[model samples]
Target: MKTILLHVSLVLCAVSSLQSRTWTEAQTGRKLEADFVKVQGDAVVVRAANGSTMQLPLARLSEADQTFVKEQAETATKPATTAAKTEEKSSGKEDAKKALIGTWDGYMADSDGSRHGDIRLVITEEKITASNPRGGQEMGAGTYKISGKRIDATGTEGQFRGKKYEGIFDLDSKTLKWCSANDNPNSSRPTQMQTNPQAGQFLMVLEKK
Candidate 1:
């Protein structure tokens, strides 16, 4: 627990800086100015000025960039760090799953902060049901999977049948924040909780009922 707390603290410190730096590609020498988010596997995640996050290959980065990532990764737990991180993620998934099994009241919002819809969601261990609370109309019913903070909801019935909604979730005891593909089933998963309806992304804010 101490190691985990230390690791989290170190990562928080690193990300808190949110400093933008020019990163150069090893071969192409192409440069991009972005803030370091975190290192994921063989790639480093960075946030562009526009708040979009992207991954760049560690090997493709200049030596200085590579060193920076390495230092961040090693600053926490050193021995078998990769395995430790994987275990941590798995544990988090289980905890999140438990926290999600409840009914929620919420509203979905468009990118421009317009009210898209009012939603009531019932989530169980095996399935999820979405409805329009004001109209008593069922909107969707689906089976959902949670992995770490990532969620995938595949519709098996109702209006959302045959569609898969991919999203990342932030959950606490009372509140849940979801950023997901909106309207377009084929759209990619959202990395942030902010809505961008033009980009086929929407944000849902819910409170446990």
Candidate 2:
């Protein structure tokens, strides 16, 4: 009876030690709040609310976050990769294809937190339209496509003057990001533009109406 009691106590102690170790590792390994900023080739850029940016391996993130990072990274790394592949197999132009066919509202901001704007995207089967409903400015006409849950759009009518604009819309969530050409004849010249030339990339968070 004494031997059995001693063995049972030993087992309970071992189990408690294992559980404590597991709980400690989990607490340390857990990500508090992460924002997927960008992808540079094989690395993923994530920004935490603490204002620290980290470029980590794509495999380190959770499954859902990994998928989001992969899609964003692929889109950033290979411009027109999807369009080229799809265009070769399909007879129709990819621009005429509409993947962002819905209403979206979001907040727009540059790399710097100074300048901000509100955006609305109205997409149809044939066209994708966006507007700054708050500023009373029209973003103009565009074409869009969805690749791996991300929406890629190229504006034909020019959003800032005559500058051509392209955007990657995350459909799984409400993130709208776009970059406009710097030296397009249709786009406003750098000297006349309000935002910095280097800050042409617009990142916005969309709210559903």
Best by lDDT: 1
Among the numbered candidates, top TM-score falls to: 1
Poorly placed runs, candidate 1 (over 4 Å): 1-89, 183-186
Model 2 lDDT, residue 95, Cα: 35
TM-scores for all candidates: the values are 0.56, 0.37
Off by over 4 Å in 2: 1-99, 113-115, 135-137, 149-151, 158-164, 174-199
lDDT by residue (tens digit), candidate 2, 1-209: 32332232332211111100011112236654555555444444556667686665544445555455434434443545777777775543343233344677865555564447677867687666778877767768766555433344556775533334433444334343433334344443222213344544445566545
Clash counts for all predictions: 0, 7
Output the TM-score of candidate 1.
0.56
Q: What is the lDDT of candidate 2?
A: 0.48
Least accurate stretch of 10 residues (summed lDDT) in model 2? 15-24
Each candidate's root-mean-square deviation in Å? 18.4, 22.1
lDDT for each candidate structure: 0.80, 0.48
